[model samples]
Target: MDTVKQSLKEASIFTHSQERPFKCSDCGSNFKRAADLREHERIHTEERPFSCSHCTKTFRTSSNLRQHQRVHTGERPFTCSVCGKGFTQLSSLLKHKVTHTQERPFKCSDCGRGFKSSGELMSHKRFHTAEGLFTCSVCGKGFNRSSHLQTHQRVHRFKSSSNLRKHHRVHTKEKPFPCSVCGKGFTQLSSLLKHKSTHTQERAFQCTDCGTGFESSHELLIHQRVHTGERPFSCSHCTKRFKRLSTLRIHQRVHTGEKPFPCSVCGKGFTQSSSLLRHNVTHTKERPFKCSD
Candidate 1:
C-alpha cells in the first residue's frame, strides 16, 4: 500500500516538474524516467532483446516485436471506426483516420512535401540527411534510397531495374523465358508469349506495306521499317544505320572492339554469340550444317 502511494506521488511530481533528471550518455537526450532512457540507449547499442517467435527477426522493444508478430498471425487489434479497415498498430489506424478527412498534418521543411502522418514525414526527412543517402560509386551521384541508386547505376540509360535487365539480356544473351512449343528461348516473357501465338497460328498484327503477319504490334512495326527503309538506330562511330537496336549495338562493338562472347575451349573471344557457337562446333566436329547435293 505504501509502494503504490509512493509511485503515485512520484508520477505526480514528474507531471509538475519540467526538468528531466535522466539523461542518455550516447545521444545526450533527456528523459523524465530512467526506463525511457534505457530504451533510448538501445538505439545506439543496436541491441534487440525482444525476438519474434514465428521468425528470425528481432526488435529493440517488446511492443515492436508484438506488432511484427501480428504480420505472421494476421492479427489486427486496432481498427478504424470510419472504414472498418484493420491495422496492426494504433499509429497506422490513426493515420488511416486522416485519410477520411484528407488532412496532411505533417509537412517536410526541406522539400515542402506533405504527409498525412508524422511517420511518413520522418521517413521523408531522412532523404535530406546523410544517414539515409545512397551514393553511386561510378558517377558519384547520390540517391535517397538504395533501390533508386541501383536503378540509376544501370549505365545511366534505363529508368527502372526491369527495363535495365531487359536491355542487359541484349548483350548477355540470357534467355530465361522458353517457348514450350518449339523449345526456343527468349529474353522477355512477352516475346515468349508472342512466340507461342505463332504455334497457335494467331497473328493479330499484320504489316500494311508487305502484307506479312506478325505475332505482336512491335514485331509488325520493326518489319514495316524494312520495307520503308527507315533506319531508326544509328551508329555512334560511323555513318551506318540499322533497322534494329540490337544490330546497332552489334555494329558499335566493331568500333569499340568489344568481344563479349568468348569460347570456353580455347579462351578466344568473338563479337557475337553466333561466332562463338560456330567456333565451338569445330572442337566437337559437329557437321550439322552441310551443302545439300
Candidate 2:
C-alpha cells in the first residue's frame, strides 16, 4: 500500500510540474518518468513483454494488450452518434465520423485527390513519384509497394522444380475446391467463388471513373488503370511496357525466344498464341478477311 501511494505521489508531482526528466535516445520522445521511458524503448527494440491471456498475441505496451482484448471480447465502447456504428478504438470512431460528414481533409498535391486520412494521401503520392523501393531479384521487376513485390516474388517460387511437382495436378485434371450449390469443382476456392458468381450475375465492385461493375475489387483496379493510364509492368529487355504482368511476360518471351505455342496440325512453333492461331487457319484454307471493292 505504501509503494502504491509513493508511485501515485510521484505521478502527481510529475503532472503538476510538467517536467519530463527521461528522454528516449532513439526517437527523442520525452517521458515524465523512467518507467514510461523504459516502456517506450521496447518499441525500438521490438520487444513484446505484455502478452494476451486469451491468445498467443503479444504487445509492447499494457494499454495495447488491453485494447487487443476487446477483439476477443467483441466489446466496442466507442460509438458514433451520426450512424450509431461502434468501434473498438476512439481513433477508429473519429475516423469513421469523417465519412458521415463527407469531408476529406487530406489532399494529394499532384492529382488534387482527396483522402479521409493522411496515411492514405501519403500512399497515393507514391504512385505519382513511381517509387520503386522493392525489386524482384529473379526477374529484376520493380514495384512501388513492398507488398506488390512480395506477391510478384511468389511467381518465381512457383516456377521452381519443387513447386512444378505440385503444379502437375493441373495437367492431371485435379479439382480441389468443390461448390455446394451446383456441385461444380475448381482447382482453387477463388475460382469456385468466381464460377458461383456467374450464376448470380452479381457485380459488387464498381469503378468510380467509368461506373463499370466487376465481380471483384481486383478486377475494378485493373479497369481503373485504363482510365489512369498507369502501366506498372515493364519489360527488362526493352522499353516496352504493359498494363498487366501476364502481357509483360508474353512480351518478354519475344526477347527470350520462348515459343510455348505450337501448331498442332503442322507441328510448327510460334512465339505467340495469335501467330499459332493464324498458322492453324492456313491448314484449314479459310480466309477470315476478304477485300472489299
Candidate 3:
C-alpha cells in the first residue's frame, strides 16, 4: 500500500511536467500550460474567439477580451488607496504608484535627464541622438522620429497650398536648435551639443554597463538597445519598427483616425501644439469684475 501511494505521488509530479501538449511547429517551442499554448497558437492562426460585447474588438486570450469589454461596461475596479482613484487594469494602478514614490529608476547616462516613466525618458533621449526613423512617402521629408513625422504630415493633410508653401521655409531654415555653450545657431540642437562635447569633452552621462560615457544618455540607451536588441515599440498597424512606444502610438493614429486635442478659442485641433496661450494683462493687478485693485 505504501509503495502504491509513493508511485501515485510520482505520477502526479510527472503529469504536472507533461501538462503542455501543444508545440509550436514553426519555432519548436513547448508551452507548460494548455491555455498559454492556445494563446501562442492564435499568434500563427490569427484566431480571436473571445470578443468584446461593447465593441467589435476580438482577442485570442479571455483576459485581454475581458479587459476590452470593461471599457464599454465603464467598470474600473482597481482603486487606489492613496488617491482613491480607479483603474480598469492592475498594470495602470502599478504605474500610478510611481507618482507617490517619486522614483525615476531610468536615467539618461548622456544628459542626466530623469523621467517619471520609462516612456517619457525614452522620448526625451531621442532629442539627443538624431535617429532618422520616420520617413515620408509623400515628399520624402525624413525625420529622426515618427512622432515628428506624423505631426509634419498633418501639415500636408490639413494645410492649404499656401500653408504648405509657407511651411517649406521651416524645413529650409537653420534655426531649430541653438547652442547652449557658445550661442551658435544650427538646424538641430543635438548636433550642436555633440560639437560642444568635443570642445568641453563632457561625457556627463555615464553608462551602467561599463561606466563608459557620452554627451547624452539617450545615445547610451540607444547603444544599449543594440546589445539587448529589445524593440519594445512595435507597429500596431504592421511589422514596422520604432525605438519608442509614443512614436508607434502616433504612427498608429495615422491608421485609426483618432485626434482628441482641440483649441478652446479658435476651435483649432492639433496633435501637438506648444500650448493654449490666453492673453492676460500681467502689468496690472486690476480685475474689473472683482472690483479689486
Candidate 4:
C-alpha cells in the first residue's frame, strides 16, 4: 500500500504547511484538494448531486451520502468501547468517548471552566464577553444565550395583571399570599389555595391506576408520568430525558454550566432555585423545619 501511504504523507504535509493550492473563484476559500474545493463550491450553487438510494434525500458529497445511508440501514459502525454506545458517525463516537473519561480538553480563559467540546467552551465564553446575541424586544434586556432570552420573554406573555404580579414575586422573594390553615406563604394565590386544600385533606385530583390523590391537576399529571414511564422532556444537547420540563431545564445547565440561581452570601451558583434557598439558610442559621415529639 505505497500509494495509500504516499497520499497520507502528502495530506499530512499539506495540513502542516497550510498549503491550499486550489482556491474557489466565488468566495476565495482555499482547499488542499480540487475535489474538496468543488464540493464546497456546491454550497454557493446549491447543487446536491449525490442522491440516496433508500430515500429522496440528497447530499453534496458522497461521504455525506454514505453517512445518510447508515440511517436506513441502522448501521452504527462506530461503537464506544467503554459505554458500548453506537454512533452513525465516527465524530459523534469520539465526542461520546470524552464523557466516559471525564476529560475536558477545552478550557475557558475568563472563568477557568472546562468543557468536553470546543462548541460548549465557545458557548461558555459568551457569558464573560457580554455580547447580546439574543435581546428581548419588549423590555430591551440583552441575553447572551437564546434559551435564557426565551425564558425571559415568557414574563411578558402573562395575560392578567395578577398573574404578572405573582410571577414578579419570585424575583422579589415576596410571598403575599399566605395559607390560612398552616400559615405557609406562597408567591401566587393559586399556590396558596392549593396548600390550603392539602390541610383540608381535599383529594380533588385522583389517579386512575394509583390511588394517590393530589390537590392540583398539575400535580396529578406529573404523578401520572411516573406510572406511564413516559419522559416528555428531553435535552437538546444529549440523549438524556426527564419526566418534568423543570428537571430537563435544570439538567441542560449541566451541559451549559449555567448557574442562574446564586447564593447571596457565598456567591455559590446552583442549577435550582430551591438549592439556593437551602444554601441561604446556612448563612442565617435558620432551622425552618422541626419535628414535634
Best by TM-score: 4
Q: State every prediction's TM-score relative to the real structure.
A: 0.45, 0.44, 0.49, 0.59
lDDT of 4 by residue, 1-293 (tens): 99999999987888889788999999999998898999999999999999999988889999999999998999999999987999999999988888777588888888777777766666666778765766899999888776789789998899999778878888999998887767889987777887888778998999999889988999999999999999999889977889998888888878776777756674456778888888889788689999997
Clashes of 3: 5
Clashing residue pairs, backbone N/CA/C < 3 A, model 1 = none
- Against the correct fold, how does model 1 do in TM-score? 0.45
RMSD of each: 23.2, 21.4, 20.0, 7.8
Tens digits of per-residue lDDT for model 1, 74-149: 9999988888899999977886898788577788899886766564555456668864366888778876644466
Predicted structure 1: lDDT = 0.80
lDDT of 2 by residue, 9-42 (tens): 9878878997888999999999987989999899
The best-first sequence of candidates by TM-score reads 4, 3, 1, 2
Clashes of 4: 0
Worst 10 residues of 3 by lDDT: 274-283
Candidate with better TM-score, 3 vs 4: 4
The 10-residue segment of model 2 with minimum total lDDT is 253-262
lDDT of 4: 0.84
> Which candidate would rank higher by lDDT, 2 or 4?
4
Where is model 4 poorest over a 10-residue stretch in terms of lDDT? 262-271
Better of 1 and 2 by lDDT: 1
Which residue runs of candidate 1 sit more than 4 Å off their true CA positions? Answer: 1-7, 108-134, 143-151, 156-293
- What value does the lDDT take at residue 144 in candidate 3? 55
